[model samples]
Target: MERLQKVIAQAGVASRRKAEELITQGRVSVNGEVVTELGTKVTPRKDKVEVDGVPIDREEPVYFMLYKPTGVISSVKDDKGRKVVTDFIDSEQRLFPVGRLDYDTSGLLLLTNDGEFANQLMHPKYKVGKMYIAKVKGIPTRESLRQLERGIMLEDGKTAPARVKFVSGNKSQGTSIIEITIHEGKNRQVRRMFEAIGHPVLKLKREMYGFLNLKGLNSGEARELRPHEVKQLREIVEKNKCN
Candidate 1:
């Protein structure tokens, strides 16, 4: 037996926090009885759990790594008829992107039906690094790039310290390519960070998430994550918790 919110989250109904809200709002029921208690525990195998009157099945979790192309939405569905990341995969289980990539940004995206797994990875405290290869306008000086390494202030707030490296540059063309790794999931963060340094991003593509990369996959292609890969990701999250 486990906490009701945890069970709901593990079943991919919602994140544990959202599950708690659903419980308090009287939207979650256990065996035909409305259960509004926060810490209620029930046998998941025996108890019938429903959210918003719809019973949730404890399906086996599925994970996929997709080479998300630029112009694809990192979502299960889109309202404006735009192509979504999930459209590239074939899966019966309801899968959602663990975290979102901007509609115009591309590369390494993960889709999964495990809410608990998704929550842990997406949580700010986890510190899972996401690396991006960005081609920006003007070449930034080392001093300017050091600001990013030391955490620069943004409109939202000061950003966390990031790992920035100069990959290549074209002094004649006034363009440069840099690799940046950040753990935060702020909206358009990579682009904004470069813009703040007076080097607006001309192109951006995520190169890695934690240790996972788009090693063999082509753009718009996807593959199931091996069991060990999933375990390694969980281990990374756990190690961060210890720190």
Candidate 2:
């Protein structure tokens, strides 16, 4: 038997967090009995489950890679009247983002209902590297690059050292595209780091997350992950356990 939330998530009914909310609201039932407890357990293959009076069936796992566009919030909901990331998803089954990309930033974002998988991706200790291509307002000097390599102090505190490199760009135009790789997922980290150095980021795009990339997928388009791709991703997460 697995946790009810896990069962619900595996069935693609909703995210584990949202499944818990459904349970709390008395919307979920197991074996024809309403269950509202957070820690309730049930067998997905044996027990019957339903949400909002609609029966849920076991479904094959689904994984997607989306090339998120800017001006959309990463969250499932926004209080200030803004479009959410879900608006871009047109799947028949329910799915949610594994992690997040800020509203102004864009690029590869994964969506899946596998709670265990999502846990591995979002857990801070994993140290899985994410690469970003950033265009900033000014060209960073060699010394500035050194400071970024060592790490920079944000409002929260000194950030972990990141891999920063200068790519080909026009210096006279006061703009440069630099590649940055960081394992930590702080709020607006790339932009914040550049701002700390007086070179604010003009545009940001996540080129890759761990082993996943946005290759071939057009902006605002999404595609299901191939079986081998999913297997490789799971292996990557397992090999790099979050400490």
Give the best candidate by TM-score. Answer: 1
TM-score of each: 0.96, 0.80
After superposition, the stretches of candidate 1 with alpha carbons farther than 4 Å from their true spots are: none
Worst 10 residues of 2 by lDDT: 115-124
Best by lDDT: 1
Q: Put down candidate 1 lDDT per residue, 1-243, tens digits, no spaces.
A: 899999998898887888999999999999999999998999999999999999999989999999999999887788999999989999998888988899889899999989889989988799999999999998899999999999989999999999999999998999999999999998899899998988999999999999999999999999999999999999999999999
Candidate 2 similarity to native, TM-score: 0.80
Cα-based lDDT at residue 39, candidate 1: 81
What lDDT would candidate 2 get against the real structure?
0.84
lDDT of 2 by residue, 157-233 (tens): 88778899999678679899999998778889889999988889999999998888998998898888999998987
Tell me the whole-model lDDT of each prediction, alpha carbons only: 0.93, 0.84
Clashing pairs in 1: none
